[model samples]
Target: MAAIHMRMLGYLVTLAMHGGNMLVMNSLLQGPVMEDPNIRTFSAMYKRFFTVWTMFLQLFVASLGLTTDYYTLKYRNKKEPQWLGVMRSVKNRIFAAVLWPTVFLVSSLFWSLYHYDRSLIYPLFADKILSSTANHILHTAVIPLVVWEVIFQPRSVPKKHGVNVTMLTVYMFAYLFLMYYTYIEQGIWMYPIFGLAYNKHICFPLIISAIGVMLFIYYHMQWFLTRIVWGSQVKIKK
Candidate 1:
C-alpha cells in the first residue's frame, strides 16, 4: 500500500511540475518577449528546439505515469487487466528509452554551452524571452526530476536495449537534418555555434558523433542506476 501510495504521489508531482512548465512556456509566447521582432521570428521555429521536444516528452510520460497509477490503484484488490499491463510496459519503455536519455542530454549540453560561453548557444538577448525561472525549469530542474523518476520508479531493462538506442539515434539524426533544413531555408543556423564553425563539414559530424557518444553513456548510466535501485532482476508489479 505504501509503495503504491509513493508511486502515485511521485506521478502527481511529475505531472504538476511539467504542467507548470507548459504554463510558463505558454506565458512566454504571450508575454512581452513576442514584441521583439527577432524573438517573434525565432518563436516560429520554436518547435524545432530539442528542449521543447523533451518538454513535450516529459509531459507525455508524466501523463502516462498518472494514468498507470490510477488503474493500478483501482485494480489493487483484483487481478490486473492486460491493458493495464500493456500501459505499464509502454510507460516504462518510454521513460527509459526516450524521456531519461533526452532530458540528460539536453540538460548537460545546454548548461555546458551556457557556461562555456552563453553566446554560443543561448545569447544575452535570449534572457529577455527566457526568464531565469523558465530557463531553469527547461534545463536544470529536468535533470533532478528525471533522476528522481529513475530512483523511485521500478522499470525492467528492455530485452532489446538496442532498439531503444536506435530510436534515440534516429531522433538525433532527424534533428540534425532539421538543423540543416532550417539553415538552408532561412539562411541562418539554428544555433549560433553552427555559424561560428570554421568548417561545417568537419564540425557538424563531430557534433553529431559527440551527441551519439553522450546518449550511449547516458543509456548505460540509466541501466546501471536501475540495477542499483531495483536489483539485478526488477520485478514489475502487474
Candidate 2:
C-alpha cells in the first residue's frame, strides 16, 4: 500500500497535466478548437496533421494508468480477479517494459526536429499558438513524469514481451501508411518535413527505415529496462 501510494503521486501528477491539455483542447468556451488560422496547424487534421505521436501516447498512458490503477485498487488484497485480463488488454507488460520508455525517445526526436528546424516539424508563425502552459505540459512535462513512472513502477515483463516490439513497429508502419493515404485522399502533407509536396520514391523508404530504427531502439531499451530493474530478462510463458 505504501509503495503504491508513492507511485500514485507520480501518476496523479501525470494525469492532471495530461488531462489539463485535454481540457484545454476541448474547453468549449475557452477550448483550443475554435477556428483560428494561427493555430490551424495545431488543432486540425486527425491523420493528415502534424506529428500526433505525443498526443496519442500521452493519452494512452494517462488513460491506461488511470484504468489499471483503478482496477489495482478495486481488486487489491482480493482473490485472483480480472486484473490480468485488464492488463492483457493494454498488453501492459510491453507498455511498462518498452513503450513507456520509448516516450523519452519520441519526445527527444520530436523536439530535436522542432529545434533543428521549426518549420520542418512545426511551423514558425504558429510558434506562440498554444499557451505556454499547454505547450510545456504537453511537450516538456512528459519527461519528468515518465522518468518517475520508470523509476517507481517498474512492472513485470512477460516472457514473450518481444510481441511489443513487433506491435509498435506495426503501429509505426500503419501511421506511415495512413499519412500517405490521407495525402492521397485530401491532397496535403501533414508535417513540414514532407514539404508542400513529396516524392514518394525517396521519402517512403526513408520513413519506413526510420520506423525500423525506432523499433530497434525499443528492443535495446527493453533489454536495458529489463536488466536494470529486474536485474535480468524475465519473460512469462504464453
Candidate 3:
C-alpha cells in the first residue's frame, strides 16, 4: 500500500510539473491566444498541442488520486500499510480527493488579498477566456478539492521527521520564479497576484505576501498530514 501511494503521488507530482512546464513553454511561444473577433486563430497546431499534452497530464493526475482512494479502501484495516488510518470516513476520503486544487485556490486568494494594492497578480487572470461566470465558478470549486487532499491523503507517515521550514521557504521561491516563467512563456496568468506590477513599488510587498501564503499553506498541510497519517491510528484487539 505504501508502495502504491508512493507511486501514485510520484506520478501526480510528475504530471503537475510536466504540465506546468509545457504550459509555460506554450505560453512563452504563443503569448496568450486570445480569441479575438478579428483574428480567427484557433489553429490545428494549437488544438493538437494542448489536446495531447493536457490529456496525458490530466489522466495521470486523476488516476493517481482515484487509485490512491481505491487502495485505501482495499487495505483500510490491513497492518503494515503506510497510509493506515489516513481516511477514517467518507468525508476524509472526499477531502483527500479535493485537497490539491483547493490548496491552489486558497493560496491564490490569500496572496491576492495580501497584495491587494499591488495588482501584479491581478492582470494576468482578469480576462475570462472561458467566460467570466464559468471561470469564477471554477475558481470557487477548486478550493474545496485542495483542502480535502491535504487533510486526508495517505502519506509515508514519518514520525519525528525534522520539519524544515527552510525547505518549504525555498520551494515557494522556486515556485514563484517558475510561475513568472510560466506566465511569460504561456502568456496566461495562473494567479491574479502576478498581474499588479504596473511599474509601482508594490513588487516587494506582494512577493512577501505570496511567500507568506505559501508558508502558511505548507505548515498547515504538514500538520494535517501528521495528524491523520502519523498521529492517529486504529488498533485491532485480538
Candidate 4:
C-alpha cells in the first residue's frame, strides 16, 4: 500500500514538472523570442527537432502515468478495466522503449557538443533568446526525471526485445529523413556539425551510424538497470 502511494506521488510530481516545462517552452515560442528575425524564421522548424519531440513524449508518458494511477486507485477494489490495462501497457512500452533512451541521448549529445563547441550544437546567440531555466529543463532536468521514473516505477521486461529495437530504429530513421528534408528545403543543416562534414555523403552516414549504435547500447543499458532495480521477475498488473 505504501509503495502504491509512493508511485502515485511520483507520477503526480513528474506530470507537474513536465507540464510546467511545456508551458515555459510554449511561452518562449509565442512570446518576445519571436521578435528576433532569426528565431522567427526557425520557429516553424522548432518542433521538428528531436529534443522537442522527446519533451512531448515525456509529457505524454507522465500524463498517461498519472491517469493510470488515478484509475487504479479509484478502482482498487474492482477488477481492472480493459481500457485501463491497455493504457498502462502503452504507457510502459513508450516510456521504456522510447522516452527513456531518447532523453538520455539528447542530454548526453547536447551537453557534450555544447561543451566541445557550442557552435556545433547550440550557438552563443541562442542564449540571448532562450532562458537558462528553459534550457536546463529541456536538456538537463529530463535526465533526472526519467532516471527517477526508472528507479521508482517498476516495468515489466518485454518478452521480445527486438520489438523495442525495431521501434527505435524506425524512430531514428524517421528523424534522419526529417533532418535531410529540412536541409533540402532550407539549404542549411539543422545542426552545424553536419555542415562541418567535408563529404556529407560519407560523414553523415558514419555519424548517424554512431548514434544508432549508441541508442542500441542505451536500450540494453536501460533494460539491464530495470532488471537490476526491479529484479528479473517483475510482474505487470493485468
RMSD of each: 2.6, 4.2, 9.6, 2.7
Report RMSD for candidate 3: 9.6
Per model, state how many residue pairs clash: 0, 4, 30, 0
Lowest summed-lDDT stretch of 10 residues in model 3? 37-46
Which digits, one per residue and each the tens of the lDDT, describe model 3 over residues 1-238?
4644654554465456445644653553443454542122222233322123323434444555556556765776875365434433433332233234234534465455636752433333334233343333333433443443444444433344244444444544555576566667766434444554423558846766865765456555645654665454422211
Candidate 4: lDDT of 105?
94
C-alpha lDDT of residue 167 in model 4 = 82
Give the TM-score of each candidate. 0.89, 0.76, 0.44, 0.89
The 0-to-1 C-alpha lDDT of every candidate, in the order given, reads 0.80, 0.60, 0.45, 0.80
Prediction 3 TM-score vs. true: 0.44
Give the Cα-based TM-score of candidate 4 against the true structure.
0.89
Candidate 3: C-alpha lDDT: 0.45
Candidate 4 C-alpha lDDT tens digits along 1-238 = 5555666677677677767876766676767667887687567677887888898888788888888888988999999899999998888888877888888899999999999989998966577546888788789988877777777776656678887887888888898889889888988777888777625678877888888887988887887788888775464344
Give me the displacement of residue 84 in model 1, in angstroms: 1.5
**Candidates 2 and 4, the one with greater TM-score:** 4
* lDDT by residue for model 2 (86-148), tens: 664573554554455456555666688777876776666444445667666656777776656
* lDDT of model 2 at position 40: 56
lDDT of 1: 0.80
Return the lDDT, model 3, position 154. Answer: 42
